[model samples]
Target: MVTKVVLNGVAIQAEEFEEEVIRQNGVPLHKIRFAFKVRSNEYHDIATLLYEKTFDVSVPEKDLNFRGTIQNYSTSVTNLYKENEVADYRLELVETN
Candidate 1:
């Protein structure tokens, strides 16, 4: 089981994680979905990092690494801009072809 995942150069502890293989037009791709928390103070940096939509993904516990694109993303709170607020974030990524 993957307990942590690295995006770009930032490492985040996973609250929930899932990995699977999916075939698209006979090509197998690696897809991962995970959940984690984001704090108000860290929101700006995270947003900036994700703005590119693609980054290096690494799961050290599984010895896996790849370049991936964001397929889906969501956050539980809209008020993360407030000081001291924390929000739950869910992200999905798929390996680039």
Candidate 2:
């Protein structure tokens, strides 16, 4: 299990992030989701992670550290501009090695 997400040099809070491994189109990838309440004004500079295209992920429980590229980016728009948006940030990372 992923215990922390460190992008650049910032440590994103665990409460706002979720991590898992899953197969998409028969390819294995690390899936990370960021679900922050609309109230928290903390922007972890998600754009940088997307633009940089790579990050170091820590799975503390497993004592693993690896770097991967952002293979996919997506968001969930509950109602577009008409309503509050939630669950709207996600990333799919494929290990280069």
Candidate 3:
């Protein structure tokens, strides 16, 4: 139930957050999914950050930090180039091995 997530040093207010530990070949990995909103003014910065693919992910409430890559991503609005627009974004990140 993490309420905030820090990605590459940028703090994001998460509307929803979920974390899971999954084992692959008996090795544990952290996977997190979170949702947030992006305003028109923030679209550029958020897009640039996500486009980087990999991140230093942090969840203070969970005391979690890891170098992760994007596992899934989605946005509610595709046309966020205009002013006064807001988009809902969902992202999933998995810890790098």
Candidate 4:
């Protein structure tokens, strides 16, 4: 399965991404959240954009079937911007069948 999520104009690879499972109907539902670090101070504006933007997730291939939703999201800005620090986030992917 190929899962792709884009946040703040930055596209993230969702492969091997961390997922939290919530069970329903004896089935495992997954909630996946990704944290990405910002490398440049110029990303501040883009970081702010995170508050207003909704991510686009693409699953080109899926052997196992599931449904997805945006459960929650938030963002953070540093006092003094630095590289390799988290700037913002998209959403928590809630997967259900």
Q: Which candidate gets the maximum TM-score versus the true structure?
A: 3
- What stretches of model 2 exceed 4 Å from their correct place? 14-40, 77-87
| Candidate 3 C-alpha lDDT tens digits along 1-97 | 3388999999999978989998878889999998999999999999999999999999998899999999999999987899999999999999999
Please give the ranking of all candidate structures by TM-score, highest first, separated by commas. 3, 1, 2, 4
For candidate 1, the TM-score is: 0.92
Ranking by lDDT: 3, 1, 2, 4
Error of 4 at 49 (Å): 10
- What residue runs in model 3 are displaced by over 4 Å at the alpha carbon? none
For residues 1-97, what per-residue lDDT tens digits would candidate 4 score against the true structure?
3365554345555434555678878888766776554446646665565545344344334322245656776546644266655455445666636
lDDT of 3: 0.93
Q: Which scores better on lDDT, 1 or 3?
A: 3
lDDT by residue (1-97, candidate 2, tens digit) is: 2245565565544445556777767776666655332211333355444578877766465464667777776656433333433345566565655
Report, for every candidate in turn, its global Cα lDDT versus the true structure: 0.89, 0.55, 0.93, 0.54
Per-model tally of clashing residue pairs: 0, 0, 0, 0
Tens digits of per-residue lDDT for model 1, 1-97: 3388999989988877999988888888889999988999989888888798998999999787989999999999866789999999999999998
Error of 4 at 44 (Å): 12
**What TM-score goes with each of the models?**
0.92, 0.52, 0.94, 0.43
Which TM-score value belongs to model 3?
0.94
lDDT for predicted candidate 2 compared with the true structure: 0.55
